[model samples]
Target: MRWTVHGERTILDTPWVRLRSLDVEQPDGARVAYDVVRLRDLAVATAVDDQQRVLMMWRHRFVTDTWAWELPMGLVEDGESPEAAGARELEEETGYRPEVMRELIYAEPAAGITDSRHFVFRAEGARRVGEPSERNESDRLEWIPLADLPGMIARREIVSSATLVGVMALLLDLRA
Candidate 1:
């Protein structure tokens, strides 16, 4: 069963987010206006080192009023590939350049109401290039041992859905 989308009306449009009301008919024959959030595709870089540590930042999200660890990530600009965007964010936010990068996973954190896409990439190892060009990104940067992920997650220290999904996929890859 699939829902029928009759039409959509833009409620608010912005460079970062778009709000829209969709006229949809459910499989059960009920029609209603459903609100959806549209966001730019996000590119996330999970850089790891030879020491088996993953690069991360401790940052505060004002919207949630919470602090957590997150990977270097940003919106994918128009005409840029997800990989390229991930690389740019990694360098800008962390001052590290990946020697090699590859796709790890893709996730839609809130697909039920948002068309946002998350492109997660794994950077095998990185080398420090210079100071981060994008300031105020985070409070501290660290190469966190992968072994600490479970504990960090258990303590609610890593809360971003993108980071959670990416790390879980990485952990699964390790088992494979």
Candidate 2:
């Protein structure tokens, strides 16, 4: 099933996000209008050390007004590759640099009303080189054991969708 776009109009355009109004023909031959959110694609990195621990950050998101464990992530800047963005975010968020980085998975966190792609990466051989860059993004960073993820998620400790998907992808890769 496919929908044909009749026309589209931009309602709001900002540097960080854009909202568009789409007029389309639905798959059932119905005409509809949808408010679509256009956001920059982001990349999240699951950095694992020699002991198989996953690096996580405890950050408070103002929009959600909640603190949760999240993997190092950031928006994919214009003209930058996902891999590069992942590496840059890993360093910027945790002050750790990975020697090896590989794509683990790609997902759309919300597909119905938004167009944002998240690229997850597996980074190995990471080492802390200096203090964190003092960015206003995170409060604390820690390396947690992979096996403890399920309990953390259950307790609402790890709520970031990209982080969850990234860890699950790594787990699936190992099981395969």
Candidate 3:
């Protein structure tokens, strides 16, 4: 059984997000309203080097009040393709350029109440160009060994949803 959305009303709209109140009807003939958050799609880059290391950013999320390692990512701006945004964010945040990039995974972090999508790209043969264009994006940037990821996740040090998904997908592909 599927829920039918009869209509929607905008509760809040802004450049960053849109909150909608949906008028929906269930298969059981029950009608109700649901609120959903809509956000611009995010592009995430997982860059791996020749030495089996991944370029990552050590950053603090104010909302979560936690510091963790994360893949370089950002919202896809208007008219920007997710691949282009992934490559752009990789360089902007980590000062590394992807010699090759391909889509690795696509995910939605919170499906129950949000329409946010994440496009994760696998980048190989990354080279450092210079300092990051956006220094404020992270406290420190480092190349962490891919083998160390399982321990980091177990320690709760790599906690970003997109980062976790992207890294695990790449790891699984590597293992296979």
- Which stretch of 10 consecutive residues in model 2 shows the poorest summed lDDT? 130-139
Clashes of each: 0, 0, 0
User: What number of backbone clashes does candidate 2 have, counting pairs of residues 3 or more apart or in separate chains?
Assistant: 0
The TM-score, computed over Cα atoms with residue i paired to residue i, of candidate 1 is 0.97
Q: In candidate 3, which residue pairs clash?
A: none
lDDT of 1 by residue, 1-176 (tens): 99999999999999888999999999999999999999999999999888888999999999999999999999999999999999999999999999877999999999999999999999876899998999989859999999999999999999999999888888777788
lDDT of 3: 0.92
TM-score, every prediction: 0.97, 0.95, 0.97
Candidate 2 colliding pairs: none
User: Per-residue lDDT of 117-174 in model 3, one digit per residue for the tens?
Assistant: 9999998778889889987899698889999999999999998899999999989878
Poorest 10 consecutive residues of model 1 by lDDT? 167-176
Comparing 1 and 2 on TM-score, the stronger one: 1
The C-alpha lDDT values of all candidates are 0.93, 0.89, 0.92
lDDT of 2: 0.89
Measured with C-alpha atoms, the lDDT of residue 70 in candidate 3 is: 96
Which residue pairs in model 1 clash with each other?
none
Residue-level lDDT tens digits of model 2 in 13-91:
9989999999989999999998999999999989987787899999898899998999999999999999999988999
Model 2 stretches with alpha carbons more than 4 Å out: none
